[model samples]
Each structure stands twice: as C-alpha cells, then as structure tokens.
Target: MLGEPAAMTENTGDTPRTLRLRADDNVAIVVNAFGLPAGTVFADGLTLLEFVPQGHKVALVDIPQGGTVVRYGEVVGIALRPLPRGSWVEESSVETPVAPDLDALEKATRVPAPLPPLDGYTFEGYRNPDGSVGTKNILAISISVQCVAGTLDVAIRRIKQELLPRYPNVDDVVGLTHAYGCGVAINAPEAVIPIRTLQSLARNPNFGGEVMVVGLGCEKLVSERLLPAGDVAADTGVVRLQDERHAGFGMMLDSIMTMAEARLEVLNRRTRETCPAADLVVGLQCGGSDAFSGVTANPALGHAADLLVRCGATVLFSEVTEVRDAIHLLTPRAASPEIADALIREMAWYDDYLAKGGADRRANPSPGNKKGGLNNIVEKALGSVAKSGTSAITGVLAPGERVRDKGLIFAATPASDFVCGTLQLASGITLQVFSTGRGTPYGLAHAPVIKVATRTELAERWSDLIDLDAGRIATGHATIEEMGEELFRLILDVASGHKQPWSDRWGLFNDLTLFNPAPIT
Candidate 1:
C-alpha cells in the first residue's frame, strides 16, 4: 500500500526575499527574496524572511509609521509611530493593547497572494486504494461503535507488540477506538466535530488496512464505510464481532494475526530515498502557544518555513486565529479570487463571531501562554504570524478541507493544536513541525510530528518528547539560523523512517478528535 517516499535535498540555503522589509512599514515581506545581500547593506545571518536578516527590507520604499503596513495585503498591526522611507517596518503595536488597539491589529492579518509552485514535489507515502497518501506504516483495526471498543482494544493489546522487530518498517499497530460508534443517532450528525474525527482516522494514509465492525455488530459505522472493505490492494476486509463467523475475542485476534501478517511483505517493501524539498509536506503548526510561542517558536519556525518554501517544499500553516495580527502578510499570494474572497469572508465571520458576546481569537490565547508570559492575544498573533515566513499567501482554507495548491497557505480553525494539525495531516502531510510552549502529548495516527519548544526551559524539561528545540536561541546559546538548519535536517531524519519522539511506535493515529467540512449535499 505504501508508495515511494517523498524526496529531500541538501540544505536549502536561505531563501532570497525581493520585498524589502523597510524600517518604516509595520508589514515586511517580499514575493521573491532568493539571493544573499551584500555586507552592511543588510545584516548577514539575520534571515528576515527565511534566513534573511532582521533588517532586510522587503519594501525599499516606506510611508508614515502610524499608517497601516500591508504585506499579504492586510493590516497585521498598526505603526506605533510615524516612519520615513527605507526604514524597517515594525509590526503594529497596540496602545494600552487591551483597549481600542485590537480593532486595527486584527484587520492586518490573513490576506492573499499567488499560490507558490505545486509541481515537482511529492513525499514517499502509502497511497491507499482511494488515492490518499500516508506518512507512516500502521496496522489499523477499526471498531464500529463504542459498544465493541473495549473488546477490540483487548484483542489488539493481546497481540505481541514486541514482535514488531520482525517488521522494522512498520511505524505502529493501533486499534481505532471511539467514544461513539453506536448509541448516537446514525444521522444525528449536524456538523459535529468528532464525527469528522472518525472519517479522518478512517481516511488517514498511515494505516495499512482495517479489519473491523462493532465487536457486537449492527453498529451504524460498520466496516462498509470504515475499512476499504472489499478492496484487495488495501489488503483489507471487514468482519463483525457479533458475526457467527468470527465469534470471540480470541477468534478476532487470530483473524487479525492472519490479516495483519499478510501485509508485512507489502509494508516491508517500501524504503526511503532522496526527494526534492517541495515533495515534503511538513505541516507548520503551533499549539499551547503562549506569548513566547509567537515571539520565539512561531517566528523561528517561520524562518525555516521560508527556507523550505524557497527550496520548493510545501509548507501548510493553519489556525486563522493565531495569524490574526498578520493576515495581511498572506493575502498577496492568493491563488485565485475565490481564495481571496474566502479570506475576506472568514475575516468578517471571525469579526462577527467576537462581537456576539463572545471574544474573538485574541482572547483565545491559552492560559499557559499568559502564564508563560504572553500578555494578550494581539501580541500573541503578531508573534504567531512570523511562522509563515515571507512566501506569498497562496490560499486560505477553513477546517476539514483539502490543499492541492502550494506556496505559503493557511488552514483556518480555532486555536486547538490537534484540531488544526489533524486537518492539515488529513489534507496530505507525512510530517509536521509542531511548536509548543506548555507540555501536551498530541500526535496524529500517521504524521510523525517533529516537536519543537518555544523556550529553553521547556526544551530541557521535555527533551524526550521534543525532536528539535529552537528555544536555545532564546538562551542565546544558539541562533535562529543554526536552529533552522538543524530543524531542516531533522525533518529528513523523520521522513527516512527514524522513529519520532512522541509516538508510542504503535502508530497511534487518532483522528477521533478532528473537524472536517461537509460537501454541500
């Protein structure tokens, strides 16, 4: 079921940025910043976009500082003061931020640009019979409903997990459990987030095949929809637990053994190879983002993101709320008018969403971020926007959607890490660069997350869980350039079948907590 893996290249030197980040504009980014700058003209090793120095000007010309700064064609923040031409654009700062300052800042983020190139890129993944790509190798046993989840988990757990040594290529073996498979209305679905989670898991590419139904049978979510039920290539077949055929848990395990064993040869048949950078679809995600997250991890990763984009890898950054302060930086890259229009629509949607007695994303910055020293959401958004680098804003998306385009893109969702990460994974990412402040163990079924931390303290505290740490930059022992290059190589290691830190190696791809959009019927 696994196809050839995606390709990788030698270190992508810093991407060149053409749009000069003038000292005067609050917004600073260029559509094309690909070459190195001469000494003194721009700071060396600063990487303003991706490895561009902090003083690099995406806009050579400038306007009054108090005037709005536009990048992707939106207002990320307002100028704290007036500015002169050729001055570096500073991100908009709020006046007594919690007061009236938010109105102007939120308007500056989530704009559009042309879609970056999408050709000549691919990751080596298992393409299910349905044509989806998976990043890892996993054996999946789907339970039809909550009724039989326990029985199936027991059957899965009883298997010799240690025996995986015989199958070095496999990522993990897991039983897909749900809080509901039965007991809920079959059609009670009304844009339920968890329902989308089930479909996401069933649709994930990391899994080799599924053998399941309710351990009892008659569950609404039978093998018919969950597994590739009748597909031979998927090496899949669905059986009901209540079926007179596969009667007991013992019998189910035996059946699973035979079913799982048959896929070993196919799973082992795959191996890693060099692919272009663009072939790698690493989800650029942040969670448990605190004030420092935007300031530290977010922008640091953005530097790497711009480098990857320049090298031609597909980078997907999500959570529209997190980018609220800098949506304007993304708009200029809009792939189409529809994408641009969708961007505007969601902007208003979020605006009205907040005005209705509910706070908008600004209030959504987590408590950890506040305690870790983030002040308010606007400041957090300003920092979070840096993760996208300086690539064009190719497309704007809502949750539970597909991304077939390239360049710098956004997938919209509330501020939950797993929710946005899962949506990006479902779209097509075998790897993810996850930055976190406080600790949380969240991993997708197939996507082997490359975890990063915002600060050095959290990095040392959770070193075992983290794959890379940019926090050292905060400590001054390391620079963003050093960290960015380190992260780029680490990405290659994960893609090459090296076991990731957060995974149990049982291939726990939980899509049960996802949110997907429904096609209009």
Candidate 2:
C-alpha cells in the first residue's frame, strides 16, 4: 500500500499532488514541497479552496458540522464546523476524539502469526562473558554522585588523550555521569528507578563488562551500590575523590586515570566475532513527526522491525504518551493475556503520573509536530504506532528496568528524546533507529543511532545527519518493503562496524538524562 497515491498528476512536471492512504479516507495530504495555492486543481478534479501547506490535509468530500475527519481509515478528529470539499483541514478546525477505554478492550485476540524464520544472517560483535554481545568494545566509568562528574570529565579527557591511543582495539572510553545519587530521597519507594537505571546502565553490553565506579565519599548512593553485584570483575575498581589518599585535584585525577587504564587493558583485548543476528537488541523511536511519518518513515521502520523480529532479534518500541491514544490497536496484538495486562498497567501508571503533574495526552504534540501537519495527539499517536510493525507484543518493561525477555517489547518511557534514549540504553539496547520528520541531531554515546528522515526535502538538506531517507516512499521512488530491507541491511552493517551512522561519524552524542520521578530534596 505504500508509495501508491490515490490521485496524482500524469506528468513529472510541477503540478498539484495529493496522497490518500485509504479508499474510505475523506482527507488527502498535499505532497508538493512548497504547498499548493488556491484554485489549483488535482488530476482527480479536487481543487484547493485555500492554501494547504505540504504535509497538511485537505478535505476530499463535503462534511457537515461535527462530522468525522478520516485519515488512515480512522476518525482522527471531529469537524469543528461544516467543511466543504477542497478546504484545507487546519488544526483549529478539528477536535480530538475521546481515547478508547482501557478496561473494555479485548486481550490477545488478534496476535499475528510469526513471520518466517530468517536465518544465516550475522554481524561481527564483541561477546561478553555474561552471554550478552556488544556492538562496540568500550570501557565505561560510572559515577555514583553528581559531585564527581567534573572530576570524571577531566579524567576522561586525559584518558582519551593519553591512554586511549595506546589501545587500538578499544573503541572509546565514556564517563557515565548523571544528575542522580545525592541531595534526593534515595530511600523513597520510587527512588529505586534511578538507582536500578544506573546499575543496569553500567552493565550495558557495549561497555564490555569492564565496570568502574567513581564517587564522592559522602553521597547517599555509594560507589559499591552502583556496581552490578555478582557480575563485577575481580579487577573492577572504584576511585573516591574524597578519600584521604587524594590530597588535591591532581591526586584525584591520577587515581581515576590509573583505574581507567586497567579497564582499558581488559577492553582492548576484546575482538569482534561473527554473531548471529539474534544477538541484536534494537530500539525504535520517532520525534519531530509529521503526517508523512505514518505514510513513509514509520511504516518503513515498522517493516524493518518485523524483519528484526523474524530474525529472532529483540526490538523495543517506547514513548508512553505517543502510545496512549493508540493503545486500543496494540492490546489485541499482545502475545498473551499477561502481556496485555502488563501493557495496560504501564499505560495506567503513566496516566496517573501525567495527572499528578497536571498534564494530559493533548500536551504531547509540539509546535513542530503541528507545523509538520500533526493536528493533535490522537493523529500523532496513530502515526507513531506504525513503527511497531505487525509483530505481537512479546514483553513489557517498566521505566528503568533491564530487559529479561528477547522479542518485541514495550519499554515504557517518556517522549523526550534524551530521556527515552537514556532509558532505552538502560534497557540494554545496543542500537537505536530514530525517525524524524522536522529533523533532529539526536545520537547516543553508548550506541549507534540510525536516523531516518520522513521527508526527502529534509533528508536532502541534512544529508550528513540522516542515515536513511524513508521520504522516498512519499515521492513514489521507493516502496516501504524496499526501504525496510535497505534499513535492515544498514542496521546489520552498522552493528557489525562495517559502516558508521552519521551521528557516530561526527561524534554528535547527547548527554545522559536520568528519569527521577521521586521527590528531589
């Protein structure tokens, strides 16, 4: 169904064009980059009554007041007033519909049959002792409190400059610093989230199991607590800046660099081996979305997700607010009744969290989303859910929880790009695929993020930033299946270190943002 426009001009010359996803849909999105002006007519005889921006929808049929505005074969909104055919469907003229009731939904009734098993696919990766594989072999230094962040930053620069060059096999050294640990309610029941997130993050496969911790002696979260118990290597070391052994900043720096070199020695000996595709754990997310998101980028990403699932890989899709309005479509796809309940439970918890903050799902779509033609959260949710593909939801993870199962998972996290990426990293995703419409330069320091652009124009403009151009689907140049296949291959190439995403090539890594829901003292 992708790349098949319902109404299009015959010639390749500049003319008005629109794309309708389904036969019953009464609205079609304008495809021209600069938009079509008033009185411009389409091949199917639908004329524009007013200017409709690119990616914005136009009514395909006359509708009375309070009539439903259909897109993607679903009711996205209600007409604010009588809308004549050829009228541009502005965001203000549409009202969001009520979300589906959670308690009344069916459970696991329409689980999709598994796709054919894909075998003989493999990537070169580093195999850790704990049975997890890593796409990169890097020594990660963890911090227990924010107080040591500056000290760790200084030490990391020295390590990267003086020590890293000595180890050719080791990829890079990263200091895992965050805003948790001190000056907060560490004993609060909700405090476990950040604590466990920090603990799990230190064990990320990319770190090559060489975990080292740095701490200020008096922080509530001690250095030992941040290290993974029973999994830490005998040589796992911790450096305390407040220790009596450190007389000054110079001694503190020397201590950290000394510990870092030991970890690098271990990590440098690790080498990439051929591993099955099943070893991959990937995260799927989107931001700066537009109406074309569902039509192109998301669908293509969905197709790739399906392929990953078929290959026995673990794939995670998140963003609770983005999934809330589309929960109705996902419940029945749960692999079991238990999985369905887990999905609903996460949704309910997030609902309460938002309500406590005096916010609602309507607050999700940003101004960029609206300018990109996402009128409301309802419309955005419908487009956002397309990245899940048709795979059955096999597992669920609460925020900050490490993954225990290996399949299509719902890792509940906020919609913020940095926060979601952080949580996904904590959940053990070694690679991430982020799709955007309006464009973003988000990348992860611990993993490779493959950025996919929803429109060709943005991709062409930011050629160095975007890794894949799913926008070709909207331009009738590529099918979703083709793009999906290409993306899957690219994922393997990147994971194997055969190729590097633009973000990695440019070292455009974002800071680690911890989601601390508990009260901060």
* Number of the predicted model whose TM-score against the real structure is largest: 2
Assess candidate 1 and give its lDDT.
Answer: 0.55
Each prediction's whole-model lDDT (CA):
0.55, 0.90
Where is model 2 more than 4 Å wrong at Cα?
1-11, 231-235
CA RMSD of each candidate after superposition = 10.5, 1.7
Per-model TM against the reference: 0.68, 0.97
lDDT of 1 by residue, 253-298 (tens): 6766666566655665655444566656678887776534654466
lDDT of 2 by residue, 230-267 (tens): 64442356888888989999999998998898888889
Mark the regions of model 1 whose C-alpha exceeds 4 Å error after superposition. 1-134, 162-166, 183-197, 208-216, 227-236, 345-362, 475-478, 502-512, 516-521
Poorest lDDT segment (10 consecutive residues) of candidate 1: 1-10
